[model samples]
Target chain A: MAQNDSNTKDMILSLNSIEVLYDSVLLAIKGVSVEVPRGGMVALLGSNGAGKSTTLKAISGLLKAERGKVSRGEIKFDGKLIGDILPQDRVALGICHVIEGRRVFDHLTPDENLEAAAPISMSRAKIKSEKERMYEYFPRLAERKSAQSGYLSGGEQQMLAIGRALMTQPRLLMLDEPSLGLAPFLVAEIFGIIQRINKEQGLSVLLVEQNAVAALEIVSHGYLIENGRVVMHDTAGALKENSDIQEFYLGGGEGKNFHEIKHYSRRKRWLS
Target chain B: MDWIFLSELTVNGALTGLLYSLVAIGLVLIYKSSAVPNLAQGALTMTGAYVVLAFSHNLGWPLWVAIPLAAVIMFLLGMGIERVALRRLAGRPIVMILMMTMGIDIFLRGTTLAIWGGSSRSVNLGVSYDPFFLGDMLLSRIHIVGAAVAIALFVGFLLFFRTRLGIRLRAISDDYLASWSIGISVERGVGLSWGLASVVAVATGVIWGEVQGVDQSLSVLLLKGLTVAVLGGLDSIVGAIVAGIILGILESVGADFLDPFVGGGSRDLIVAAVLILTVMIRPHGLFGRHDIERV
Candidate 1:
């Protein structure tokens, strides 16, 4: 159950043998378990359809929107069973999700997007200062704060997406694919800000990404998933050097032909 | 034709158009937040007028008390409709949701008829039924009040869009899932939108009822509002207002000149033609947001 341990108090998010299904028929996640300590950044790395996004959705209670349900297992946020809470209520509890594809409101200006993200209970002064803090993290957003978000470039839109999440002043931030379709330089820049936010604000994060190298560089721990099940979990440094991850994910290891890499991935030790 | 007569007709048409805009705005608000066409909006309007009648005439309440009370009741009714009927139908196909709204419309109409009887009733808003002169053109006071109130409501909505709650509504309309993930209650937002829209519907009905007696025929006004919404873009408030005015003018001018040549009541025909043409040309409406899909 991963409960009653002395260190469990420090765990910001914990999923114990969680199983997610779509339409009550198709299983998307099968007996997955993971944990994120308070103030620690954890990355979930996987290929497409590996259920990384689904895991984030389940933790944030966003699965109900897509007709997906956690048919089995439980998810806890800050030691509370949050699997049954609504997505909006989850935000009041200081958990915010930056969904994939940077879904900013197209008709609104960047400044307005931040305002919408701010909780209704927050005073105007708090909202304004939080917005200013976000602008400091992404100065490019400051330059385009008044422009309609839909017209912003891809990098700018991604910045707005993260900045919007930051406006909630969350204790735990879950981001899905912040690096998708972004250039390497922009990806590094965004990750740097994420790292700075985590360090300075003592915020916990659960990041899902396909860019393992960039994600691993900032994350404290990393978990590898394939076909909705966790195949490996270790410190970021260990996973970066693991033979299987080196060959299959990092594109490392010497003399590994394409066929050998594919064979190795197919028969991973954890899969058995 | 005399220039004064032409100007009078134009002014009258514009005033009537503003009323249409009032009705269409309610539909646009519901569509924007909930993505439901809200076919029942017209019925809501009819019911609102009847509620006022029940209060003022049957219950012997003053206009001041009855109007505000009726608006409050209609607002709750709107929220109830969203919570009980539309909430269950969330995430359904758009067509199915729209059909449900039609069913609601039928239900409301039948209920109103059963409770209030089918006979027409006159509503007194306490305004003097005197004709005022604008230069040489005679104007009805009711039409003038209708125009003034419609414009006021339109301005109020524009100001609303600038507030924090308005931003939440706009955010939900832009992307439901994104808004939901960021702590906005999408359901509550949609429900509130319905509530606000119903308040507008009630106002529209009261004003409209003062001009034309309240009866089952008032529901036909929904067709006019729908025509305006379709021509202007179903999701655009600005488009609805502008299209309403334009249709109103077209009906006024066409009824006077063109109707004599092509039988009676060419206004409906003209509005229908314009709706079809607008759909064929600019389906997104004059100011409606066009979805840009990125691969």
Candidate 2:
């Protein structure tokens, strides 16, 4: 609700010169800074081990544990300095990190999984209303509420992870490789839900992805990271059209050539 | 052979089963949260009984003042164990932690020997109520009250698990990193779990003292607690309680009825057999989530 609706202008998260190192030798990310305004999706694109995941982890406070220390940097979320804050405290300050691999609480039922992210103190009606609204966005989750999260399909599990994060009512949601290991149809479905969450709920997102073409289509702004530094920062459209991006990521596909590939992306439109 | 005799035996077994459940349930709580088999649990229970004996008998405190104070002291002791022993070793392999707890058990047993001078000490609550006769049977009032308290504590624990804090504990058991990320204070929760387990141990010790008298050897009751926990399921509170009752009843009834034919003392053998069967049938124990390994 703090995000802009009509004009759609607000600064939700600001990373000022974050330098993340792993084990004092492996520089996962260095001297990177980016701003994600409210109510829009921004993609951090990179290859495997290119520090895309590391950047998201730095913001979420997960990277700090893996010797991925933020040696010199500051992370400000919703006007608060969060670099020294504990991960759980960061979660309390309205930043939800949907970790990669859809790592839900597998022992819990889907409803209990959502309930885990519920604030330590809340009235019953407020909890109910928020759950109802989340169900509206993800009706499939409602049907599977009684099922254990471990039993869900990959796409369903991804939906449950996102829905559980939404339960906390975060201002900025940072998702790491949400499209990993999903069928093409589920990936597109997830992206569609991400777009809706931003537009309707006025949520801001810093999306990290290995699937460059798919991620570029969903977000407004984009950054390319390689070995712990940002190499490309531009509008999503510009990144999509960059010749190097096409050669390395999109397999030399131009506007005309993109129509011929029959892969996971095509399956979303034709198969499902 | 008489019907009246059979009814008396059934009531006695049921009473004993409730106390066993109290001790075993404590083990289940610790194992579920920290994944360590507490070899020190029996020692802790024995320590609680000895603490009460010292306060009421050696130090001249009234029974009313001694028992609750002993339980509180033991609760603090349990928290100390968590902070000093278990906290540093969390996330280590299960075998090493088990060995550490075993070492704690040995240390506690030695301390008990050194302080109590390896001698038996009489523990009396000074309740002067007479045993009442029903038909051909006599039942002591102390046993009845102890059984009632144990059952009540078990019910209270079931309710605690339904509250928000209880759910948070279960979430930690489900996934540690995920629970921490969601704002559940893992260190605080672990400490509280240890404290609760200590309270249960004190209750178990008091009842055990009443039934079997008190001595340094009374620490062996920890073995019974471990057996119950293993049979019931290490991580399941309901399973631990149920298994405790079942094992207790089995041992009591076996000693009473079958001892005549099985050379007069095979109750422990029956318990050992049941434990083997439980482990073979369900390694995770009854009600425990089967740990599914994915590569």
Candidate 3:
């Protein structure tokens, strides 16, 4: 417990060598560790099947719902051990996970989606004001406030998903693939809002993204994972300049055909 | 064919449909939140009637006091059922939880039989037995009161769905993980839905008992409610009410005109036929959202 307090004072969330398993048979994440300092934006960058989403789910306590369990290591949130806490209670502790695929309640209208995500402990007045604040941040949401979320375009749904997370007034927001299936302009717009929110509200963020270029552009710190293991961690600028990241992730390598690419090879050079 | 007789039959059928709507709405509440078609609903209805009987007949309590007491007891029983039996099965396969509900239903029925005995009992609400006349058509005051109460409850249900709690319930129904990630306790939400459904069950039982006597067979009324629920779309509250009324009219009118032709008991046959047709044509049922995939 004394050791727990040492690292968490500066970090809003800390994952210490956590391992996640699905169905008690399939290991999805192996010995992963990551952290988000107070009010800092950290990006977890990896391609599909790289365990980026699994790490985020572990922190938000959503692993159980998917038959995925954190089998090893500790997750400390705000200087307290939180691996055993329920996902719903994690929200009360101010950790919100905007899950992958912009999972807005399709049946609910945009405004009602915000209402559903409002923290149970918040007063009605606070909820109302928070809703207004959301509309102010994404004025397009105000235009389609009453439309069913399922009918919204991908970009609008992404905005509503973020707005829903904001409704919880979380201290740490864990977003999984926010820019997936969005237009480039929409990605920039959404990432800009995320940056502004982190800057203005001082909210810590742990963003998991396959789109490393977009994510690295906004995040202060970045970690690159391959096959469930963190191969590299550095400041976003340093990561952008790293040879392996530039060669494989940023598509700047000298490979014209797929076979010559470093990532196409079975072995990862960074890990070796 | 006398038009007056037809009108009376239609009006009577509509009133009976309202009662079916009340029971179906209870089914909808549990089904919507938990995705379990609570098979124990029949036993719950039986238990509710028995609770009222114990308070009113056995304890010699007044009907007014007994009804509320029975409702309170059943509500807690519903919550206890969720917490003790259903909550443990959360995230389990739908079929497994459904089977558990069936087991619960059987257990509750056996308990009812052991405690209440197998005798039919009348519930006297102390209302006047006078028949009200609409022109030449005679209407029972009890039926009128039952219809009024059912409508009032339906209206109350509509208002509930518009409240914050209702929105949360809807959110859980739509996507359980999304609801949990948003900080809504899916387990507690499901438990509350069960409790509220039981309260509806109690109201239904008391009103139903006032018209038909309270008996073990009263549990069979759940089959009619199930029919309404299936025809209306299992998750749609409005669909339940509409389907209930339609079923009532069909049963009443079918019993009147087709019973003799079909050698009696055509009401059940008619309902089964309609249910089959609805399933074949619109599997989502009236007012149910069709799950269309947008590629």
Candidate 4:
């Protein structure tokens, strides 16, 4: 970790050529570098097992629980190198990760779930107001607030998961597949809200999604990862315009699905 | 048939059931947060009683001072067990944790026996042994006081789950990953559960110790408490109390009526039977929640 990295200044997050390993074997991240400008929304677009989620987990200190560790390079949040901070302590530093699969406490109501996510010292008055703000941000959650989160629809649960993250009042919100398993309209609604939050509150968001088309619409820039290495990095507009991205990710060509084998073969040729 | 004796037995058993509920509640707290059955719960109960006995008798501390001091010590010991013993085995299989707690139970049993010796020692908390009459039934004053304390602690625990810290504990039990990502200190919540469980176990030990005396046999409480815990649905607090009362009544009535027909003691035997039956019939326990499987 470079203690005085002059280049990381003005950036909210800078992943400095980091590598990750699951267990003692199986390297999962192969020296990937990415950056999120202050208050910027960035997307990590990749197919399954491309290490996008692992990168976000690395940033949030969630990898330790899964027997994964940052084996090399540094993760600097707010220009400070990530250290031996517990996952819960990352909340104090304003890093909130809404993990994949809309993981809310099913036994609790949305209200309690939000309250549960709040810092221990958060006052009732502040929590109530923050909850109200969350409700305003997602009216669907407010309508279903009385019911247990288990009964919530996939879209509503994702909204509640995001709302719970917001209750922490985090400066950086890392979302893992927020659009997964949702209708197109609901995806647009969620992505639109995320865009609004980014613009209004200036909350830096690092969104990891396989749904490149939807993610590209809301994020300012995007990184395309293939087999643990970043293969492409560009502005959303440029990525959308790229011929390879069009055939594979943006769906202007091919069957609107990532041709994984073809893409891997192309990466092989490109690496050579 | 001694109908009056049966009714009296029922009442006494009900009060004893409350004490068992108190002990079972301790087990539920640990299993609730960590999803691991704490086999050491009975050892904790026995250790708590001996600590109080040592303080009040050997150290010559006042009864009022001895119990609370013992409670505080047990609380720290419980948390220390989590931090020092359990935390080291984090992310291991549930079976490993299960074995770890069993090891702790054995360790606690040996430490208490080594320090206090195996002899049964009684601590006089000044409860009157004179049997009091109520509607043609006899009641011990100590049983009434024990029931009162158990009820108060149960009420306190009931109120606790509604608070912020309590909600966090419940949330952690529901989803460990989500809890950590949401900023909940899962480790602390688990530690607190152990601490609270230890505190309740101490209360059970003190109340029961007053009547039965603290002995190596008191460690059998783990079996009794485990039966109540399993019967109540290991995760449910209210279930523990309900199961405790039921077990108490059944034990008392069985001892009175069936023990004579059988060879000798059947009080503890009944609990073991119920534990086995509950597992075979309803593995989730009566009040325990089924896994909230996301469809």
RMSD to native for every prediction?
Answer: 2.4, 6.6, 2.9, 2.8
By TM-score, the better pick of 1 and 3 is 1
Per-residue CA lDDT of candidate 2, range B1-295, in tens?
A: 7767677766766666667777788887777665567888888878888888889988999877888998889889888887888776655577888898888888888887788777666667664468767667877677777778877877887788767677677777766666655666666677778888888877777777877777766678776777778877777778766777677678877788788888777877887788788788877776777765443
B76: Cα error in model 4, Å: 1.1
Q: What would the per-residue lDDT of candidate 2 be over residues A39-92, giving only the tens digit for each residue?
A: 778988878887777777888787644556788878878767799987788888
State which docking tier applies to candidate 4: medium
Model 4 steric clash pairs = none
Candidate 4 C-alpha lDDT tens digits along B1-295: 8889989999999998988887888888887776779999889999999999889999999989999999999999999999998886766788898998999999999999899998888989899999989989999888999988888887888888888888888888888889989888878888999998998888989988987999988878788888999999998889988998899999999887778788768887898899999999999899997777667
> Model 3: clashing residue pairs?
none
Residue-by-residue lDDT tens digits, candidate 3, A114-215 = 998887777999989999999998999999999888888999999999999999889999999999999999999999999999999999999998889999
Q: Model 1: runs farther than 4 Å from truth?
A: A1-4, A254-272, B293-295
* Ranking of all candidate structures by their TM-score, best first: 1, 4, 3, 2
- Model 2 clashing residue pairs (backbone): A29-A228, B42-B222
Per-prediction TM-score: 0.95, 0.86, 0.94, 0.94
TM-score of 2: 0.86
Predicted model with the maximum TM-score = 1
Candidate 1's displacement at residue B134, Å, is: 1.1
Model 3: residue A214 alpha-carbon error in angstroms: 0.7
Q: Candidate 4 lDDT, tens digit per residue, A1-272?
A: 43345656878998878899999798998988888999999999988999999999999998988989998988888977775789999888999999999998988899999999888788889999999999999999989998988889999999999999999989999999999999999999999999899999999999999999899988999888888988778899988887778877666775544555456445532123
Top of the candidates by DockQ: 4
Candidate 4, superposed: residue stretches over 4 Å from native: A1-7, A252-272
In candidate 2 the C-alpha lDDT for residue B138 amounts to: 70
Instruction: Rate residue A185 of model 2 by lDDT.
Output: 88
